[model samples]
Target chain A: MLYLVGLGLHDEKDVTVRGMEAIKGSERVYLEAYTSILGVGKERLDAFYGKDIVVADRDMVEMDSDEILRDADKVDVAFLVVGDPFGATTHADLLLRADALSIPYTVIHNASVMNAVGALGLALYNYGQTVSIPFFTDSWRPDSWLERVRENMRLGLHTLCLLDIKVKEQSEENLARGRKIYEPPRYMSVPTAISQLLSLLEDSSPSASSDSSPSLASADSLDPSTTLAISASRVGAPSQRFVAGTLAELSELDEEAFGGPLHSFVIVGRRFHALERDFAGRWAVDRERWNEVSNTVYAVRD
Target chain B: MLYLVGLGLHDEKDVTVRGMEAIKGSERVYLEAYTSILGVGKERLDAFYGKDIVVADRDMVEMDSDEILRDADKVDVAFLVVGDPFGATTHADLLLRADALSIPYTVIHNASVMNAVGALGLALYNYGQTVSIPFFTDSWRPDSWLERVRENMRLGLHTLCLLDIKVKEQSEENLARGRKIYEPPRYMSVPTAISQLLSLLEDSSPSASSDSSPSLASADSLDPSTTLAISASRVGAPSQRFVAGTLAELSELDEEAFGGPLHSFVIVGRRFHALERDFAGRWAVDRERWNEVSNTVYAVRD
Candidate 1:
């Protein structure tokens, strides 16, 4: 039997009781680490579960999944994911492989940013397709997510932008030299994501330099100064932080307050209800500033 | 502090270890009962946790939230939700009230059907805005969800149709008579939802009776015979069942196999990847029929 368990977004104790039971009964446990990072380390999880977990990198999970599911037909083998097992396609692929091998599997679900982002007070139903914003480089800058954001905005739906995190990645120089040296892990912060978005929007504007082609046709519709947005850091954690304001205000927020790793950004849509605005106001870094933007955007009722 | 913990989708053991701790340390624990139903009863949870729990219906949580939060600042109060704390807007509202009252709170995240639907092998990112289909009555038949389905289909995004569940609801006569009488709980089965959808579609067709006006402008975009869909019953439960096929094929599925309660439906969009098609094919009630529909819709990449 293959047990696909989700370690919910925080400490080791966030794993469901059923998941814990599955881990206890499993002969071998593998934690898929490339997709997302947890607040705690493997040693902490090991201490909590009273068993050592084999860390499965991208290569092992994507290329050699058979090894993870080896003898699963005979005994229980646990495959752990940071968020919900199906949040990423790779995890789903794990299930696919298990199915093809005639291995019975059980999925234990946990809270993921896909649903946890509702903490920012936006109705879950009001959210459209979620988009991931990757780090932009000089040579490989992509603006594909811009279209997704625009589609949500066009429909008056909130858009949850998942920031990119590069873990166990090798540098170009190291890769070229056939070196196994890896670069430090990098997690995109809200301010960094906002700056990248601003640059992209500016470059796409009609008044920008002639060499700069618009990445999105509806670029004119988004105004950074007036468009309300929310940024959350370390969601589902004890130290979770949320700041609600305009894109411009959020871009200039205090980094010391937001602190380290795992930040999510939400672009508020035009169809804001009075209740949503009221709820968002409670999380504002500057209540006065948030209300100013909210007044301009939200159609608040008495 | 107030602890809003999620009881992840299965039995009593589905609660996270952290959630259990919260409940253990809580002076008062109230389970929100109206938004979603859990597979287990209060007695089961009480027996597992060795703690007494008070069930908070919609009235208590929505109208008398202050009562639930009474002395919360002075004591450790646990408000348990079936899925993720923020899966429903009412839970978010509770957070708002708590915030307004300056009460500190912690959210324990758990798996929600929003992400758990990935069991069908569909990517979570590929799903668009979720729609809720309510039980249609003679005078209260609503087709608003049809517009949502149309928009998602237009964008080539999968749509998760959340079937409505009526619990502890009062009849109009009971309400007007100032009586506390409640109606028996009614959970919409997949077949019932599909039949209602089919009827709505047929009624809106131009070829139908002259008195019937088409609610959908692009009525031709959706065809029941060719559109692929998936239905799952008792998701996240030990006895969970999944059936995938074209809309027409699923509309006639046997209810005995689905059995008891808690069912969800999904409408496959136009842009299905080959991997998605292959994965979804595994749950097909009729593989040959599913493949026939898939080949016409999916852009297979081999």
Candidate 2:
């Protein structure tokens, strides 16, 4: 039997009881560690679960999945993933492979950012498609994610923007030389993402840059000086920090306020409900500034 | 301190270790009922936690929240919710109230359908705005949800249609008369939802019934004979079942195939990736028939 278990979020203790039972019942446990990271290391998990965990990187899971599924037909093998198992598409491929190999599997679900983002006080039902903002290099900058955020805003729906996390990535020279060298891990910070967004907005606004008319009308809806947003750092972690303010204010926010990796941003939509505003206001770095932006820009008079 | 803990989908064992710790530390534990239900009853959770569980229905949560928040500043009060604490907006209200009362609070996240739906092999990032389909009555049949479906389809994104569940609902007469009479719970089955969708499609088709033209251009995108769907019953449960087929075939699916309550439906979008198609095809009730429709309608001719 193949058991796909979720190690919710944060440290090792966040794993669900069912997931723990599955791990204890299994003969071998493999943890997928490339896509996301837990606050604590495998040793902490080993100490907590009282089981030896083999850390499986991207190459092992994507290339040699058969080893992970070895003898699953005869014995219980547990595959652990940070966050929910289905948060990434690679796990689905693993599940499909298990099905093809006639291995019976059980999925134990746990918390992921997809659902945990609801902590921002916005109704999940009111959220449109979520977008992922990748780190921009000198020559590579993608605006498709911005288009998605614009579409959500045009529909009066909030957009959950997932910042990128580059783990175990290789440099161009190392890749060309077929070397095993890896670059340092990079996690897109909320301030960095805001700066990218502001640059894009400025480039698109006719008054800011060259008067090349924008292709998307929705791009004009967001003015960095007026649009409100919520920047969340290390969501679902014990040391979570949230700041609510205008996009400009968020870009200039104190870098030390939000610490660590796995940051996310939410572009508040036009249909911001009063209750949502009230709830989010509690986390504002400056309540007066948040109200000033929200009142004129997001106030629902009804 | 007020602790909002999530009891993940299915049985009592689905609760996270952090949630278990909170329950153990709490002086009083209240389970929010009415929005969604756990597979096991309060007795099962009580037995697992070895603590008394107070069930908080809609009235107690919406009207008597102050009482629930009373003395939270001095005590550890655990407000348990099925799925993630923020899956429903009411819990956010409770958290806001906690803040108003100067009560420190912590949120223990768990899996909810928002993320669990990824088990169907569709990438969570590719899914657009989710829609809720309510039980249609003679006078209260609103098709606004169809607009959401159309918007997602237009964007070539999958739409997760949440079937409505009526729990402890009071009729107009009962409410107006100040009586506490409750209606029997009604969980929307997949077949019932399909029947409603088919009826709506037929009614809107120009060739069906009257000769009036359809108001929505996107209505043409969904054809009962060609559009594929996934009928999921009891998601996240041990006995969960998934059947994939065309809408026409799904409408005629056997009732016995999907037993019990809490069903959901997913309308496969036009931009079905090859991997998604292959994975979803594994669950097809009739592989040949599914292939016939999928190839002619959703074929990604790469």
Candidate 3:
């Protein structure tokens, strides 16, 4: 049997009880590393599981999936994922291949950001098309993500904006040279994302730059500063931290002392359910933070 | 302190390790009974936790939220929810109320359909505006959901069509009579959802219904019966069972054989990674299962 387990959004212990059992029962355990990583390192999970793990990066999972599934018919094999096994499509592929090979398999689910975003207090039902805002460079920035966000906001729906993470990414030169070298891993911060969002909105719509605008970009529905709530959550951990604030304030905000890799952002949309607004207010305690948040516009409400 | 914890997708054991701790630590543990239900009854969770759980319906959480948080200032309290803590907007309201009352709050995350739709083998990043497909009525059926699906297919993005559940829903007649009775809960099945999708597609594009015209649904992108998969997953449980097949096959599927209630369906979109396709293929042995997936026209085709 081949088991695909979701380790959830935080550390090693985030694995479901069932997932842990599957790992313990499996003859081979592999942690797919590239698509997503646990907030804590693999060693932590290894320590918890009391087993040596084979870390499968993109190349191994994508390029060598068949080899990974070998002999699954002979004994139990477990493939561990950072979040729910299905949170990422790569595992689904592995499952499909297992099926093709007629290998029996089961999936163990776990907490992931899709539902975890509620930490900032947004309704999952009210959330619309989720978009990823990738880190942009001088030459290759994409704005289609903005269009999607605009569409989501137009419907009074909340948007969960996933920031880009470049892991083991090869620079163009390195790729062309066929070098094995990789660029440093980059996890986009809520603040950096906000700065880019502001610039892009300003560049797309001239009116957005006006002084009278209530800190909302061109697609303002609520004052962006007042509506945005960010959580620097290292979820699935005992010490997981979640601090909310507007995007503008979040940009200037610095306190994720939550150790290492993987952080995403949420762009709070308009249409408060009373509770959403209330949950968001919890993060705006300090006067300086309040001032920072006050500078954003949610939608360009007429 | 008030903690809103998601019990996760299926049952009592679905509760995360953190959520379990919160339940054990809370002075009051209230399970919101309206938005959704776990696979098991409150008694089961109570037995597992060795504590009594108060079931909070709409009245208590909304009209009398102050009562729930009243003691939070002086005690640790938890509002338990099925799925992720903020999976529903109602919890957000509860959190907001707590914040207003000066109660510190926290959210514990868990797996939910929002992320679990990958069960059908679509890339999470490739899914476009998710829309709920409500069970149609004799008079109130709306095809509006088709637009979102079409838009997603256009962009080659998968559409995670969240099947609507009517829990604690008021009936028009009951409301008119000032009665407080709720209609029975409903969970949509794949065959039914497919029927709705086919009807709406044919209705909107009548010209495409020529005798020999492709089934209005194409299999060029994926083999529906082979690629399409259905999961009657009683997730977060020991006996969870998931099956994949053509809408026609799964529609006729006996989920009782799979396990129990709270089943969801995924309408596969065109854009899929090679791995995703392979993984989704594992769920079903039929090609038509995969053929059911359509490419949304509005997505960025990335």
Candidate 4:
């Protein structure tokens, strides 16, 4: 049997009781570490579970999954993910491999950023299609995700932007040279994401006609100063921080404002419910601006 | 301090270790019972947590919220939600109330149907705005939610339809007579939701021009026979079941196929990914039909 357990966001204690039971009963445990990371370290989890966990990097889970599933039909093997198992496609692919091997698997669901973002007081139902913001490089800057945000804004729906995390990544020099050197992990901060978004908006502006795609025609609809957004860091953790402000304001914030990694941003929709506004307003960078925008720009429903 | 802890879907064991600790340390534990429920009963939770839980119904949480927060400032008070605390707007309201009273609070996140639906293999990022399907009555048959579904389909995004759950509801007669008599709880099953959707589609068809509203002008784009959908019951529970099929076929399915309450429905959009198709294909009621629709109607991507 195979057990795909979820280590809910934050520390080792975030794991469900059922998940803990699965870990305790497993013959061997593997912790998937590439897609996302828990707030605690492997040492803490090892001490809590009383089991030595084999850290499975992206290569081990993606390229050599057969090793992870070996003998699963006979003995219980637990594969732990930082969030819900289905949060990333790679984990789903691992499950598919398990299916192909005829290994019976049980998934113990726990909270992921998808649902944990609700801690910011935005109704999950009001969110539109979630988009990912990748770390923009000077040579490989991509603004394709802007269309998703634009579509969400057009439909009066909030967009949850998941910032990129590069873990155990090989640098360009190492990849070409085949040298096994890995760069230090980098987590996209809220300020970086906001700056990237602002840059994309500027590039897609009508003034930059030479370098704009037709798909980004609707980018003009978004106004950085007037649009409300909420930047959350380390959601579901004890140190979780949320700041609601305009994109421009958030872009100007220092890294110290929202410490740590695993930050997420939400672009508020035009159709903001009164309750949602009230709940989020408590965390606003400027209460006066939040109130003014709520009354003038946003269409607050009863 | 007030602790809003989420008991993830399924039994008492679904609660996180941190949530359990909060419950154990709290002077008073109140279970938010009206919004949703777990697979196990209160007795099971009592046995597991070794604490008597006070079930907070709609009235207690809404009208009598002050009582729940009366002494919360002085001692640890835990308010348990079946899913994530922010899954519903009512919980957000409670948090706002806490903020208004200057009560310090912490939210322990857990999996809700919003993210748990990913167990069906569909990526959470592909899902659009969620809609709720209420049980249709002779006089109050609402098709307003269809527009949201249509918008999702139009954007090539899947729609997660949360089936309505009526708990501790009073009948009109009982309300008129000023009685406390409550009607039996009714949970909207997948088949019932499908039938309601089908009826709405029929009503909004071009042939029924006399009765349809102008807002439903794009209703013609939806074809029940070709549209793919997945019906899930008791998701995140051990007995959870998922069936993928056309709306018409699922509507004819027996109740026995998906047992119990807390059912959810998903309408697959035209932009179905190959991976999503493969994962959902495992539960297809008609494999041949599912394949044909995938090839002919759905624009599947790699």
Candidate 5:
């Protein structure tokens, strides 16, 4: 049996009792490390579970999954993911491989950013298609996510933007030289995500547009200064912090304002319920501004 | 301090170690009983946690919230939720009340239906706004959710329909007589939700249309016979089951096929990715029909 367990957001202790039991019964345990990171290290998890874990990077999981699933038909092989097993499509592929090999599997679910974002006081049901913001390179700036956010905004639906995390990424120079070296892991901070969003807005604004780059339609719906937004850092952790304000204000925030990495951003929709607005106001960067925009721009659905 | 801990979908063992620690340290432990239910009963949780829990029904949580928050400012109090603490808006209100009483609080996240639905091989990001399906009555047959589902289908995004669960509900006769009598709890089954959905389609169809009830726009996007759907039961439990098929076929399924209550329905959107289609095929009621619909109706985005 292949046991896919989720180490819910936070430290080693966040794993459910069932997940712990599964780990204890497993002969070999593999921790999926590329997708997301837990608050604590492998040492803490090892000490807590009394089992040594083998870290599975993207290459190993994608290319050498058979090794991970080896003898699973006869023995229990535990594969641990930072969030829920199904949070990423990559894990689904692994499950498919297990199916093809006729290896039975059990999924132990846990909280991921998809539901943990509810901690910000936004109703989960009100959220539309979630978008992911990747680390933009100088030459490879992708603004397609902006269109998704705009579509969500047009429908009066909230948008949860999952910031990118680059783990064990090979640099261009290292790849070119065929070196087996990796750059340090980089997790996008809330401020960095806001900066990228602001950059996208500027690049698509009519004032900054050239003939080569057409201006985006309905771009005004996501004005940085007026649109209400929320930034969450280290969600589901003891030190989790949520800051609500305009995108421009959030962009100006420093790491001191929101400690740690693994941040997420939410663009509040126009159809904000009165209760939602009230709950979100507790974390506002500027209380008066939050009220003004919420009252004037947003349509209260209550 | 007030601790809002999520008891992830399942039995007593599904609670995280952190949540257990909180419950152990808590002077008063309150299990939220109205929003959703765990697979196990209070006695099992009491034995596991070694603490007798005070079940907080709707009235206790809503009308008498102050009673729940009493003395939280001085001693530790844990409020347990079946899924994620923030899955329901009512919990947010409790937190707000806590804030009003100057009680600092912490949230322990866990898997909710919103994220657990991903186990059905659909990406969480692909889902749009979620809709709730209530147990329809002769006079109170609300069909506003059909429009929301239609809107999601129009945007090619999956819609997760949360079936309503009625707990401690009073019948109209009992309420009218000012009696404290309560009706037995009723949970909407998968088939009931599908039946209601099909009824909505028929009610809005041109053939069944009347002058009083106007036809819905873009109703064809959610055809019962062709549109793909997935039904999930006892999700996150060891006995969790998922069945995928057309809405019509799923509606005809009996309780034996899907063993328990607390069922959720998903209406697949047209923008189904190739990988999602392939994964969903594993649970299809009719493999040939699933493939034909995938090829003809759903736009494959690879």
Candidate 6:
């Protein structure tokens, strides 16, 4: 049997109880590393899971998935994922391979970013289209995500903007020369995403499809000074924090003590329930208005 | 402090290790029973969690939130939710309430059906609008969700059709008599959902806009079959199963065995991914023939 277990977003503890049992019961366990990540390191995961795990990088997974599944035909092998197994397409490939080989496989689900965005108090249902804001570059920067964001804003829905994370990615020279040179891994911050979004929205003004432009098409709509929430969640851990504020305010909301790798950002779009608006309020526009807005946003009947 | 933790989709083992810790540490732990439910009963959940838990129904959460938050100011309190904390807006209301009352709060994230759909090998980036299909009565059959599905299908984007679950809902008679009588909950299955979708599609043929739809017309090209995959995922535990079939074949597959509540359906209106298609090959289809069709509809590979 091949087991795909989700470790969730934070530290070792983020693994579901069943996921832990699966890990302990597996003949061999592999933790796929490239797709998503836990806030805590491997050592912490190892201690909490009570088992040693081989960290599988891109090469190990894409090239060596067969090796991982080879023994599944014999006994159980559970592969750990930082979030739910199907959270990314790579794991789905692993499942497809297992199916093709006629290996009995089971998936152990855990929390992933899809539902975790609820921490920001946006109704998951009200979220229109989710878009990814890739790391910007002088040459490869793309403005496609802007159009999706506009669609959500036009319909008064929220957009969960997943920031880009480049992990253990090899540079062109390294791959060509067969050397070990690599670019440093980077996780996109909310402020950086907001800035990129601003540039993209501004870009849409000149030669865009006239009919598709947002009614709230001004530069202010993309401004970081506008209200938004940034959740620097250490999901698998106990100290997970979801701080809300205007994009500019959260950028200044104390550089986060979230304490490890694997961070994503949520940029709030318009339209919400009074209750949802309340959750968004807790992040506070500024320290000065923190108490008042916090009350107004959260002051549902309770 | 008040902590809201998502218990994921299936059983007790679905709760994240972080969520378990919060429950273990809390002076009071309550399971919110209205929005969604775990696959098992409270006793099963308690046995798996190693603690006795109080089930908090909608009345307890919506009407008695102050009582719950009031205690949080003095001692730790943990409120459990199905899926992720914010998957339902009620938890958001609780979080904002906790924030307003100066009760420090933390949200532990989990995987809900939102991202788990990726498990079916659909590109998350390509899903457009998400619509919910609510249960209908003879007098009040609603077709609004059909419109949203059509719109999303037109855009060549996939639509995540969230099946409705009516929990602790009152009966029409109960409402009329001012009684608090409750009705049994209903969770729409994929078979049931597809029944509705096919009926709507065939019935709305004349009035339905597929070719001129924004999602469909704007796409460079799209395949009707390759464009969609319907999934019935019983996520959460190791025994979870996902069946990937076309909307047509789904109604004929084994539905009861998909097992448990919190099931969701996807209407693959339009969307394609190179890797997603590659991964989708092994799921409930003939590989030799699927490959021939896959080549035609897949996104251009990187």
**CA lDDT of every candidate:** 0.84, 0.83, 0.67, 0.86, 0.86, 0.68
Residues A259-300, candidate 5: write the lDDT tens digits.
Answer: 988888899987687788889888999988887777766745
**Residues A183-231, candidate 1, lDDT per residue (tens digit)?**
9999999998999998998878755434332223232356776678898
Kindly report which residue stretches of model 4 are placed more than 4 angstroms away from their true locations once superposed.
A206-220, B206-220
The order of the candidates by DockQ, greatest first, is: 2, 1, 4, 5, 6, 3
Candidate numbers, best lDDT first, in rank order = 4, 5, 1, 2, 6, 3
**For candidate 6, what is the TM-score?**
0.84
> Which prediction has the highest DockQ against the true structure?
2
Global CA lDDT of candidate 5, please?
0.86
Error of 2 at A95 (Å): 1.6
Model 3 CA lDDT for position B249: 62
User: DockQ for each candidate?
Assistant: 0.68, 0.72, 0.44, 0.68, 0.67, 0.54
In model 1, state the lDDT of residue B75. Answer: 96
Scored against the native two-chain complex, candidate 1 gets a DockQ of 0.68
lDDT of 3 by residue, A1-302 (tens): 99888888877656666678889899889998776777677788788888789988889988898888999998999998888887744465566678779898877777777667666656665566667888898798788888777666666567777778788999989999999999888887666777788778667666643456454343444344555655555555556555666655566665453344456666666554443554555555454554344333432222
Candidate 4 whole-model C-alpha lDDT, 0 to 1: 0.86
| Model 1 alpha-carbon drift over 4 Å, by segment | A207-220, B207-220
TM-score of each model, in listed order? 0.94, 0.94, 0.79, 0.95, 0.95, 0.84
Clashes per model (N, Cα, C within 3 A): 1, 0, 57, 0, 0, 16
**What is the number of residue pairs that collide in model 6?**
16
> What is the Cα-based lDDT of residue A251 in candidate 6?
57
Tens-digit lDDT track for model 4 on A68-163? 999999999999999888885536688888999999999898999988888877778888999999999879888888898888888888999999
Question: Model 3: which docking level applies?
Answer: acceptable
Better of 1 and 2 by DockQ: 2
Looking at candidate 1 chain B, the ten consecutive residues that score lowest on lDDT are: B211-220
- Lowest summed lDDT across 10 adjacent residues in model 2 chain B is found at B211-220
Docking class of 6: medium
